[model samples]
Target: MNKAVFPLLLLSFSSLFPAHGSGNETAALHRRYASAATEMHRVQVAMDAINAKLICRGCKIDVVDEIFSTDFRLKDQNSLGYDGKYSEAVYFDPPKDLNQTNAAPERALSYRGWYLAVKFDKNGELIDYYLTNIHK
Candidate 1:
């Protein structure tokens, strides 16, 4: 194999397997909603939500950006100190971002691993559990 092709081949091979994929780890989150994809691939060392359990449905929003993103917001190092492989970070408000998007979960939950976009009804009670993503 040519040296140049070798590097490309390596990249392709690496891509086949996610460096950090989902795992069997189970995390109990305090947040209302959660995403399977985020949890599935959250482990610093390969982990995924294929066989894990989280707050909301263990699901993935096809159009990720529509939900939550750090695109315009600056990233911060501070954390809520919540320890878990899965998070309940919601990011989108639906009306604006969901107007035009691909097939995804009913609601958007944690985007990536940190951000959470929460929504409340008339009352001020937490009411998003299992409502963020689709249930499998």
Candidate 2:
């Protein structure tokens, strides 16, 4: 979370208290959560929520494959996964059924000149995120 957003969100928090009496709970709740969420984060969160609703493991894996589709490609989802060894497959192939390790390969990307490695589960769901930059 960005520390800068906290103060703004906290300012919006006070508006939520009056929502129950006015029968605008949904709107208020939306305001509460949406006040600080970026446009990109909303898309990512909605994607993850829908992905979680997939019942079958194969269905989930299928979503992983679709990650490379034009829609996702427009969102820059084609970042390659790496596992230190840099197998050609990791660089060239889509992120599905990673065989290198028990855990999924880290999907590496960059932002603001810093490198990031996003970890994932076997099913290709995001586990956590870690970023590092080479500094002198």
Candidate 3:
């Protein structure tokens, strides 16, 4: 009887301590998250570069006009039956080279048209702009 009981106890203890699977699933998930974060950061850097170039070229009237015009069109498309006119405003903040640390010139511009607002950083090249009318 004692021998039988001892064998059962040993079996229970061994079952309680299962073998490890080397954490393959956790490692895979971590790798995927890291890759996604890296991709996002790369995209942000590219955009920043584009914005800086646009700012360095000086503010052109055609570019500003096009951005505002597109904003108006989007607002009109999403407008209600009311007769209110949509307005677009552009804000520009140029990066200052005060300390001369050779930092890339920062060009931050935001265009708010109707209910849509678009923002670009210094490194973003002004290739395309998107606006959505979210006015209720």
Candidate 3 residue-wise lDDT, 53-109, digit = tens = 321222222333332233333343454234333334332222233454546576443
A best-first ranking of the candidates according to their lDDT comes to 3, 2, 1
**What lDDT does candidate 3 reach at residue 18?**
26
What tens digits encode model 2's per-residue C-alpha lDDT throughout 1-136? 6999998999899544321122243233334334424434433433442334321222232232233121211222344456421111112112244254556566443323232233443444434433333323
- TM-score between model 1 and native: 0.20
Question: How many residue pairs clash in model 2?
Answer: 0
- Prediction RMSDs, each to the true structure: 17.3, 16.4, 22.7
Q: Per-residue lDDT for 1-136 in model 1, tens only?
A: 5988999989989545423223223222211124434442233111122222221222232112122232312223342224312223343232234334557657444323332333222222223332233322
Q: lDDT winner among the candidates? A: 3
Off-target runs (Cα >4 Å) in candidate 3 are 1-64, 67-70, 80-83, 94-136
Selected candidate, larger lDDT, 1 vs 3: 3
lDDT of each: 0.30, 0.34, 0.35
TM-score quality measure for candidate 3: 0.17
Off by over 4 Å in 1: 21-91, 94-136
**How much is the lDDT of residue 18 in candidate 2?**
24
